[model samples]
Target: MNNEKVTVTLELNKDEARALAQFVKRTSHSDCEDKATSQNEAYLMMDGVNAVMKSLAEEGISPR
Candidate 1:
């Protein structure tokens, strides 16, 4: 990974922020690490969340 970092900003309402925080709280780590392979689960999760945010933005919809 590169030694670069970013600070993203979002203007979410209290309810929306709380909901996202709750979702993150409920997320569980997967045990996909066997002796031979290690999975990049965080990347998978980030991709999914990014896709959802992009879709909502394209549709001009707010997540409930």
Candidate 2:
């Protein structure tokens, strides 16, 4: 068995990026039946989004 990781490149326009960010932000703030689990997942998702956006910004590929 092998465990490995791969990198993916996503090409999104400014509007699409903005929309995705907004969606992630909203998800991070939303509630559900499984509050703890759902919120954890949302926060993790938000963190991933932030990390990617930060990396892109560092590379001068920001939406703004």
Candidate 3:
């Protein structure tokens, strides 16, 4: 795998962000992992997703 990293910017409304967080939370690791990527990369991606969820909660945009 390439070690290069890229930045991604999204423009999601509060509800959309909340829904995305919930969806990521419900997704299984095996279901989300790609056949070409390493396990560590998948875990790191999950960690980044978790960070976004936490940030959304901090902004008071959590799911009911």
Candidate 4:
């Protein structure tokens, strides 16, 4: 696979930017600084949403 670099600009509040920087520092220690890192994070968030939805469904609550 060819490795090319892409640039993405994000506008974050000061607190959010600091949090993202801290997260990057922590995850980079585990060798997770790559394109797929954000994708993995997104999947993790989606999984949490799915779990919440499942619990709500069990309680007969509509999440519409």
Candidate 5:
């Protein structure tokens, strides 16, 4: 297999999406520095992604 990176898309319901949005806002405000908006938004997005992955791992879940 090639070492190329692939993007993974997430599909969340309305409630889930809303919760993630809230989480991002909260985390970004507390964890991010006084940097550019783009950097802060990226940090928020990665926070959400890490949260989902961690949740799945805790539940012994797989993407298969």
Candidate 6:
């Protein structure tokens, strides 16, 4: 596994940011593992979130 920094910038309101932060915290806490597993889980979550955003966009909901 490669240890690198990937930056993601989202334009979200305070509520959205808080919600996302809570979601991430909950997911991360659900498992106890090393840093690699934690990072992989985070990536998987971001991927899922991106897919949802794309689907929403296709349904005419602008992601931005």
* Candidate with more favorable, higher lDDT: 2 or 4: 2
TM-score, candidate 4, is 0.40
Q: Cα RMSDs of all predictions?
A: 9.4, 5.1, 3.5, 16.2, 10.8, 10.4
Model 4 agreement with the true structure over 1-64: per-residue lDDT tens digits: 2336444444566566455444433343124324235766655545444544454445444333
Pairs of colliding residues, candidate 2? none
Candidate 4: where is the Cα deviation over 4 Å? 1-37
TM agreement with the true structure for every prediction: 0.48, 0.45, 0.61, 0.40, 0.39, 0.42
Residue 5 local lDDT, model 6:
53
The candidate with the higher lDDT, 1 or 4, is: 1
Which ten residues in a row are the worst by lDDT in model 6? 27-36
lDDT of 5 by residue, 1-64 (tens): 2446556667776567566655643554335545436775666656555766565445444233
Tens digit per residue, CA lDDT, model 6, 1-64 = 5556576555766567555554544444234233336766766656655654554454444423
Cα lDDT of model 3 by residue, 1-64, tens digit: 5657666667788778878878867756665476328788777777666767777777777666
Candidate numbers, best TM-score first, in rank order: 3, 1, 2, 6, 4, 5
- Candidate 1, residues 1-64, lDDT tens digits: the string is 5536555656777677656655644444442223213357555555555655554455455454
Count the clashes in each prediction: 0, 0, 0, 0, 0, 0
Give the Å shift of residue 6 in candidate 1. Answer: 1.0
Q: Please, what is the whole-model Cα lDDT of each candidate in the order they appear?
A: 0.52, 0.58, 0.71, 0.46, 0.55, 0.52
- Candidate 2 lDDT, tens digit per residue, 1-64? 2335557788888777676655544444343323546766666556566766675665555553
Q: Score candidate 2 by TM-score against the native.
A: 0.45
Which clashing pairs does model 4 show? none
lDDT of 4 at 45: 48
Q: Of the candidates shown, which would achieve the greatest lDDT relative to the real structure?
A: 3
